[model samples]
Target: MDITKGYSIAYKGLKNGTHDFAFKVGGALFEAYGSAEIMGGDCDVEVKLDKSETQLVADVTIRGDVVVACDRCLEECRVPVDFEGRLLVKFSDEVREYDGEILWLLPGEDEVDLAQYIYESIVLSLPYQRVHPEGGCDPEMLRRFRIVSDKEFAEIEDRAGAEPDNTAWGKLAELKERMEAGPQDDEK
Candidate 1:
Protein backbone atom coordinates (compact mmCIF):
# COMPACT_ATOMS: atom_id res chain seq x y z
CA MET A 1 0.00 0.00 0.00
CA ASP A 2 1.09 3.58 -0.55
CA ILE A 3 2.66 5.08 2.56
CA THR A 4 0.83 8.36 2.16
CA LYS A 5 -2.54 6.65 2.18
CA GLY A 6 -2.22 6.14 5.93
CA TYR A 7 -2.19 9.88 6.45
CA SER A 8 -5.45 10.59 4.68
CA ILE A 9 -8.61 11.18 6.66
CA ALA A 10 -12.06 10.16 5.38
CA TYR A 11 -14.05 12.79 7.12
CA LYS A 12 -17.11 13.30 4.92
CA GLY A 13 -19.22 10.89 6.91
CA LEU A 14 -18.03 12.08 10.30
CA LYS A 15 -20.24 14.11 12.61
CA ASN A 16 -19.44 17.64 13.72
CA GLY A 17 -17.00 17.01 16.56
CA THR A 18 -13.35 16.59 17.45
CA HIS A 19 -11.56 13.45 16.28
CA ASP A 20 -8.07 12.15 17.09
CA PHE A 21 -5.80 10.51 14.57
CA ALA A 22 -2.29 9.07 14.63
CA PHE A 23 0.05 8.09 11.81
CA LYS A 24 3.49 6.61 11.68
CA VAL A 25 6.07 8.16 9.40
CA GLY A 26 9.07 6.22 8.20
CA GLY A 27 11.81 6.26 5.55
CA ALA A 28 9.25 5.08 3.00
CA LEU A 29 7.41 8.37 3.19
CA PHE A 30 10.59 10.31 2.44
CA GLU A 31 11.42 7.96 -0.37
CA ALA A 32 7.92 8.38 -1.77
CA TYR A 33 8.46 12.12 -1.80
CA GLY A 34 11.93 11.67 -3.35
CA SER A 35 13.56 13.63 -0.57
CA ALA A 36 17.29 13.88 -1.08
CA GLU A 37 18.16 15.55 2.20
CA ILE A 38 16.27 13.18 4.48
CA MET A 39 17.93 9.79 4.23
CA GLY A 40 15.52 8.09 6.66
CA GLY A 41 13.52 8.61 9.81
CA ASP A 42 10.92 7.35 12.26
CA CYS A 43 8.30 9.82 13.36
CA ASP A 44 4.89 9.87 14.98
CA VAL A 45 2.23 12.27 13.79
CA GLU A 46 -0.68 13.17 16.05
CA VAL A 47 -3.56 15.15 14.70
CA LYS A 48 -6.53 16.45 16.68
CA LEU A 49 -9.15 17.43 14.16
CA ASP A 50 -12.13 19.50 15.16
CA LYS A 51 -14.75 19.16 12.47
CA SER A 52 -17.72 21.38 11.90
CA GLU A 53 -20.13 22.20 9.11
CA THR A 54 -17.79 24.42 7.16
CA GLN A 55 -14.25 23.82 8.42
CA LEU A 56 -11.83 21.57 10.28
CA VAL A 57 -9.27 22.75 12.76
CA ALA A 58 -6.33 20.40 13.05
CA ASP A 59 -3.80 20.46 15.85
CA VAL A 60 -0.72 18.68 14.62
CA THR A 61 2.21 17.46 16.65
CA ILE A 62 5.13 15.53 15.26
CA ARG A 63 7.99 13.99 17.18
CA GLY A 64 10.82 11.81 15.92
CA ASP A 65 14.35 11.70 14.51
CA VAL A 66 15.54 12.03 10.94
CA VAL A 67 18.85 10.94 9.43
CA VAL A 68 20.71 13.41 7.23
CA ALA A 69 24.25 14.25 6.28
CA CYS A 70 26.16 16.07 8.97
CA ASP A 71 27.12 19.57 7.95
CA ARG A 72 30.58 19.19 9.50
CA CYS A 73 31.49 15.57 8.73
CA LEU A 74 29.21 14.61 5.81
CA GLU A 75 28.31 11.42 7.68
CA GLU A 76 24.84 10.28 8.63
CA CYS A 77 23.59 12.23 11.62
CA ARG A 78 20.31 11.88 13.48
CA VAL A 79 18.42 15.11 14.07
CA PRO A 80 15.42 15.42 16.34
CA VAL A 81 12.08 16.55 14.91
CA ASP A 82 9.55 18.36 17.06
CA PHE A 83 6.77 20.40 15.56
CA GLU A 84 3.45 21.62 16.98
CA GLY A 85 1.13 23.80 14.97
CA ARG A 86 -2.42 24.39 13.86
CA LEU A 87 -3.92 23.73 10.45
CA LEU A 88 -7.23 25.23 9.49
CA VAL A 89 -9.09 23.41 6.73
CA LYS A 90 -11.47 25.81 5.07
CA PHE A 91 -13.94 24.87 2.38
CA SER A 92 -14.42 27.10 -0.63
CA ASP A 93 -16.34 26.90 -3.87
CA GLU A 94 -13.28 27.57 -6.00
CA VAL A 95 -10.00 25.65 -5.96
CA ARG A 96 -7.48 27.24 -3.64
CA GLU A 97 -3.88 26.74 -2.63
CA TYR A 98 -2.77 25.46 0.73
CA ASP A 99 -0.98 28.11 2.68
CA GLY A 100 1.31 27.02 5.49
CA GLU A 101 -1.34 27.74 8.12
CA ILE A 102 -4.48 26.88 6.26
CA LEU A 103 -5.64 24.21 3.80
CA TRP A 104 -8.28 25.19 1.32
CA LEU A 105 -10.44 22.51 -0.25
CA LEU A 106 -13.59 22.27 -2.32
CA PRO A 107 -16.83 21.29 -0.61
CA GLY A 108 -17.12 18.08 -2.62
CA GLU A 109 -13.89 16.57 -1.42
CA ASP A 110 -14.50 13.60 0.89
CA GLU A 111 -11.00 13.02 2.20
CA VAL A 112 -8.28 15.36 3.44
CA ASP A 113 -4.83 14.33 2.40
CA LEU A 114 -2.37 15.38 5.09
CA ALA A 115 0.68 13.59 3.69
CA GLN A 116 2.16 16.72 2.16
CA TYR A 117 1.62 18.78 5.28
CA ILE A 118 3.17 16.20 7.57
CA TYR A 119 6.16 15.68 5.31
CA GLU A 120 6.87 19.38 5.05
CA SER A 121 6.43 19.86 8.79
CA ILE A 122 9.02 17.25 9.61
CA VAL A 123 11.49 18.67 7.10
CA LEU A 124 10.96 22.18 8.35
CA SER A 125 11.41 21.12 11.97
CA LEU A 126 15.00 20.13 11.25
CA PRO A 127 17.68 22.62 12.21
CA TYR A 128 19.13 24.86 9.53
CA GLN A 129 22.58 23.49 10.32
CA ARG A 130 22.21 19.74 10.80
CA VAL A 131 25.31 18.19 12.33
CA HIS A 132 26.43 15.77 14.98
CA PRO A 133 27.11 17.17 18.39
CA GLU A 134 30.60 18.37 19.34
CA GLY A 135 33.08 15.49 19.47
CA GLY A 136 30.43 13.19 18.04
CA CYS A 137 31.44 13.41 14.38
CA ASP A 138 33.97 11.01 12.90
CA PRO A 139 37.44 12.38 13.58
CA GLU A 140 38.71 11.23 10.20
CA MET A 141 35.97 13.07 8.35
CA LEU A 142 36.56 16.15 10.48
CA ARG A 143 40.23 16.15 9.60
CA ARG A 144 39.53 15.63 5.93
CA PHE A 145 37.17 18.58 5.61
CA ARG A 146 38.78 20.95 8.12
CA ILE A 147 38.38 24.58 7.17
CA VAL A 148 41.38 26.90 7.26
CA SER A 149 41.53 29.00 10.39
CA ASP A 150 41.92 32.77 10.36
CA LYS A 151 45.48 32.53 11.68
CA GLU A 152 46.45 30.19 8.87
CA PHE A 153 44.89 32.45 6.21
CA ALA A 154 46.61 35.49 7.70
CA GLU A 155 49.96 33.71 7.74
CA ILE A 156 49.58 32.69 4.10
CA GLU A 157 48.58 36.20 3.12
CA ASP A 158 51.58 37.62 4.96
CA ARG A 159 53.92 35.17 3.27
CA ALA A 160 52.48 35.99 -0.15
CA GLY A 161 52.94 39.74 0.50
CA ALA A 162 56.52 39.29 1.78
CA GLU A 163 57.53 37.59 -1.46
CA PRO A 164 58.65 40.24 -3.97
CA ASP A 165 57.20 38.30 -6.95
CA ASN A 166 53.39 38.11 -7.06
CA THR A 167 53.32 35.02 -9.25
CA ALA A 168 51.35 31.75 -9.04
CA TRP A 169 54.50 29.76 -8.16
CA GLY A 170 55.04 32.04 -5.16
CA LYS A 171 51.67 31.06 -3.68
CA LEU A 172 52.25 27.38 -4.50
CA ALA A 173 55.62 27.40 -2.77
CA GLU A 174 54.09 28.95 0.35
CA LEU A 175 51.38 26.28 0.46
CA LYS A 176 53.96 23.54 -0.06
CA GLU A 177 56.03 24.91 2.80
CA ARG A 178 53.00 24.95 5.11
CA MET A 179 52.00 21.42 4.14
CA GLU A 180 55.50 19.95 4.56
CA ALA A 181 55.95 21.70 7.91
CA GLY A 182 53.05 19.65 9.32
CA PRO A 183 49.90 20.83 11.09
CA GLN A 184 51.43 21.87 14.43
CA ASP A 185 54.94 22.77 13.25
CA ASP A 186 53.95 25.36 10.63
CA GLU A 187 55.29 28.42 12.51
CA LYS A 188 58.28 30.38 11.08
Candidate 2:
Protein backbone atom coordinates (compact mmCIF):
# COMPACT_ATOMS: atom_id res chain seq x y z
CA MET A 1 0.00 0.00 0.00
CA ASP A 2 1.11 3.60 -0.58
CA ILE A 3 2.45 5.18 2.56
CA THR A 4 0.73 8.45 1.80
CA LYS A 5 -2.70 6.79 1.69
CA GLY A 6 -2.89 7.03 5.45
CA TYR A 7 -3.19 10.77 5.19
CA SER A 8 -6.17 10.72 2.85
CA ILE A 9 -9.70 11.24 4.14
CA ALA A 10 -12.76 10.31 2.17
CA TYR A 11 -15.20 13.17 2.70
CA LYS A 12 -17.79 12.42 0.06
CA GLY A 13 -20.31 10.87 2.40
CA LEU A 14 -19.91 13.21 5.35
CA LYS A 15 -22.81 15.28 6.58
CA ASN A 16 -22.48 19.05 6.15
CA GLY A 17 -21.18 19.83 9.64
CA THR A 18 -17.92 19.44 11.55
CA HIS A 19 -15.56 16.47 11.88
CA ASP A 20 -12.33 15.64 13.64
CA PHE A 21 -9.49 13.55 12.22
CA ALA A 22 -6.15 12.47 13.57
CA PHE A 23 -3.15 10.93 11.84
CA LYS A 24 0.29 9.75 12.81
CA VAL A 25 3.04 10.94 10.55
CA GLY A 26 6.19 8.93 10.40
CA GLY A 27 9.43 8.48 8.42
CA ALA A 28 7.43 6.88 5.63
CA LEU A 29 5.82 10.18 4.71
CA PHE A 30 9.19 11.92 4.42
CA GLU A 31 10.62 8.99 2.48
CA ALA A 32 7.68 9.04 0.05
CA TYR A 33 8.49 12.66 -0.77
CA GLY A 34 12.20 11.89 -1.08
CA SER A 35 13.08 14.54 1.51
CA ALA A 36 16.79 15.21 1.78
CA GLU A 37 16.61 17.51 4.80
CA ILE A 38 14.42 15.22 6.93
CA MET A 39 16.22 12.00 7.78
CA GLY A 40 13.31 10.71 9.86
CA GLY A 41 10.35 11.98 11.83
CA ASP A 42 7.49 11.09 14.20
CA CYS A 43 4.64 13.56 14.34
CA ASP A 44 0.96 13.87 15.15
CA VAL A 45 -1.42 15.74 12.86
CA GLU A 46 -4.76 16.97 14.17
CA VAL A 47 -7.34 18.42 11.86
CA LYS A 48 -10.62 20.03 12.88
CA LEU A 49 -12.65 20.30 9.74
CA ASP A 50 -15.81 22.34 9.32
CA LYS A 51 -17.65 21.43 6.18
CA SER A 52 -20.41 23.35 4.50
CA GLU A 53 -22.17 23.40 1.17
CA THR A 54 -19.52 25.50 -0.45
CA GLN A 55 -16.22 25.00 1.33
CA LEU A 56 -14.20 23.12 3.91
CA VAL A 57 -12.09 24.89 6.50
CA ALA A 58 -9.56 22.93 8.51
CA ASP A 59 -7.56 23.95 11.54
CA VAL A 60 -4.42 21.86 11.67
CA THR A 61 -1.83 21.30 14.38
CA ILE A 62 1.33 19.22 14.07
CA ARG A 63 3.98 18.49 16.70
CA GLY A 64 6.89 16.09 16.73
CA ASP A 65 10.65 15.57 16.42
CA VAL A 66 12.59 15.09 13.24
CA VAL A 67 16.18 14.01 12.75
CA VAL A 68 18.47 16.19 10.67
CA ALA A 69 22.16 16.92 10.32
CA CYS A 70 23.49 19.27 12.94
CA ASP A 71 24.77 22.52 11.47
CA ARG A 72 27.68 22.75 13.90
CA CYS A 73 28.64 19.08 14.43
CA LEU A 74 27.85 17.26 11.17
CA GLU A 75 25.97 14.57 13.10
CA GLU A 76 22.39 13.39 13.30
CA CYS A 77 20.44 15.80 15.55
CA ARG A 78 16.85 15.58 16.76
CA VAL A 79 14.93 18.79 16.05
CA PRO A 80 11.57 19.65 17.53
CA VAL A 81 8.63 20.44 15.29
CA ASP A 82 5.54 22.45 16.24
CA PHE A 83 3.16 24.03 13.77
CA GLU A 84 -0.43 25.28 13.64
CA GLY A 85 -2.16 26.57 10.54
CA ARG A 86 -5.50 26.75 8.77
CA LEU A 87 -6.27 25.32 5.37
CA LEU A 88 -9.23 26.10 3.18
CA VAL A 89 -10.44 23.50 0.73
CA LYS A 90 -12.25 24.92 -2.25
CA PHE A 91 -13.75 23.08 -5.17
CA SER A 92 -13.74 24.23 -8.74
CA ASP A 93 -14.72 22.73 -12.06
CA GLU A 94 -11.65 24.22 -13.70
CA VAL A 95 -8.32 23.13 -12.34
CA ARG A 96 -6.91 25.37 -9.63
CA GLU A 97 -3.58 25.28 -7.84
CA TYR A 98 -3.07 24.88 -4.12
CA ASP A 99 -1.70 28.26 -3.01
CA GLY A 100 -0.37 27.50 0.49
CA GLU A 101 -3.48 28.66 2.34
CA ILE A 102 -6.07 27.08 0.08
CA LEU A 103 -6.35 23.63 -1.45
CA TRP A 104 -8.30 23.27 -4.62
CA LEU A 105 -10.03 20.06 -5.55
CA LEU A 106 -12.02 18.94 -8.49
CA PRO A 107 -15.71 18.35 -7.82
CA GLY A 108 -15.48 14.67 -8.68
CA GLU A 109 -12.69 13.99 -6.21
CA ASP A 110 -13.84 11.81 -3.31
CA GLU A 111 -10.93 12.18 -0.91
CA VAL A 112 -8.61 14.98 0.20
CA ASP A 113 -5.01 13.90 0.24
CA LEU A 114 -3.13 15.73 2.99
CA ALA A 115 0.25 14.07 2.48
CA GLN A 116 1.87 17.16 1.01
CA TYR A 117 0.35 19.60 3.49
CA ILE A 118 1.30 17.54 6.53
CA TYR A 119 4.82 17.02 5.23
CA GLU A 120 5.28 20.73 4.49
CA SER A 121 3.91 21.82 7.86
CA ILE A 122 6.28 19.56 9.72
CA VAL A 123 9.27 20.60 7.62
CA LEU A 124 8.46 24.28 7.96
CA SER A 125 8.06 24.01 11.72
CA LEU A 126 11.74 23.10 12.15
CA PRO A 127 14.01 25.83 13.44
CA TYR A 128 16.19 27.53 10.84
CA GLN A 129 19.34 26.60 12.74
CA ARG A 130 19.28 22.92 13.67
CA VAL A 131 22.03 22.13 16.16
CA HIS A 132 22.70 20.13 19.27
CA PRO A 133 22.62 22.05 22.55
CA GLU A 134 25.88 23.27 24.05
CA GLY A 135 28.12 20.22 24.73
CA GLY A 136 25.39 17.86 23.57
CA CYS A 137 27.14 17.04 20.31
CA ASP A 138 29.77 14.30 20.11
CA PRO A 139 33.16 15.74 21.01
CA GLU A 140 34.94 14.06 18.12
CA MET A 141 32.40 15.21 15.56
CA LEU A 142 32.50 18.74 16.94
CA ARG A 143 36.28 18.72 16.76
CA ARG A 144 36.21 17.43 13.20
CA PHE A 145 33.78 20.09 11.93
CA ARG A 146 34.86 22.95 14.17
CA ILE A 147 33.75 26.38 13.06
CA VAL A 148 36.32 29.15 13.37
CA SER A 149 35.41 32.14 15.49
CA ASP A 150 34.90 35.46 13.70
CA LYS A 151 38.24 36.78 14.98
CA GLU A 152 40.06 33.64 13.83
CA PHE A 153 38.40 33.86 10.42
CA ALA A 154 39.41 37.50 10.10
CA GLU A 155 42.98 36.64 11.05
CA ILE A 156 43.12 33.86 8.49
CA GLU A 157 41.88 36.25 5.78
CA ASP A 158 44.45 38.84 6.78
CA ARG A 159 47.27 36.29 6.70
CA ALA A 160 46.10 34.94 3.33
CA GLY A 161 46.13 38.50 1.99
CA ALA A 162 49.23 39.90 3.75
CA GLU A 163 51.69 37.02 3.18
CA PRO A 164 52.13 37.75 -0.51
CA ASP A 165 55.81 36.65 -0.37
CA ASN A 166 54.92 33.14 0.84
CA THR A 167 55.01 30.56 -1.97
CA ALA A 168 51.43 29.18 -1.94
CA TRP A 169 49.88 32.43 -0.73
CA GLY A 170 51.86 34.39 -3.28
CA LYS A 171 50.66 32.17 -6.08
CA LEU A 172 47.04 32.53 -4.94
CA ALA A 173 47.41 36.32 -4.69
CA GLU A 174 48.94 36.44 -8.17
CA LEU A 175 46.04 34.46 -9.56
CA LYS A 176 43.61 36.78 -7.76
CA GLU A 177 45.33 39.80 -9.28
CA ARG A 178 45.29 38.26 -12.73
CA MET A 179 41.59 37.47 -12.46
CA GLU A 180 40.80 40.99 -11.18
CA ALA A 181 42.79 42.51 -14.05
CA GLY A 182 40.31 40.92 -16.50
CA PRO A 183 40.89 39.19 -19.83
CA GLN A 184 42.37 42.17 -21.70
CA ASP A 185 45.20 42.80 -19.21
CA ASP A 186 45.93 39.05 -18.83
CA GLU A 187 46.12 38.68 -22.65
CA LYS A 188 48.51 41.65 -22.86
lDDT winner = 1
Count of backbone collisions in candidate 1: 0
Q: TM-score for model 2? A: 0.76
lDDT of 1 by residue, 110-133 (tens): 999999999999988899999899
> Worst 10-residue stretch by lDDT in candidate 1?
165-174
Model 2 C-alpha lDDT versus the unseen true structure: 0.84
Q: Which parts of model 1 have CA positions greater than 4 angstroms off?
A: 147-188
- lDDT by residue for model 2 (59-80), tens: 8999889999988877899998
Report lDDT (Cα) of residue 73, candidate 1: 89
Residue 65, candidate 2: Cα error in Å is 0.8
Per-prediction tally of clashes: 0, 0
In model 2, where do residues sit more than 4 Å from their true spots?
Answer: 147-188
lDDT of each: 0.88, 0.84
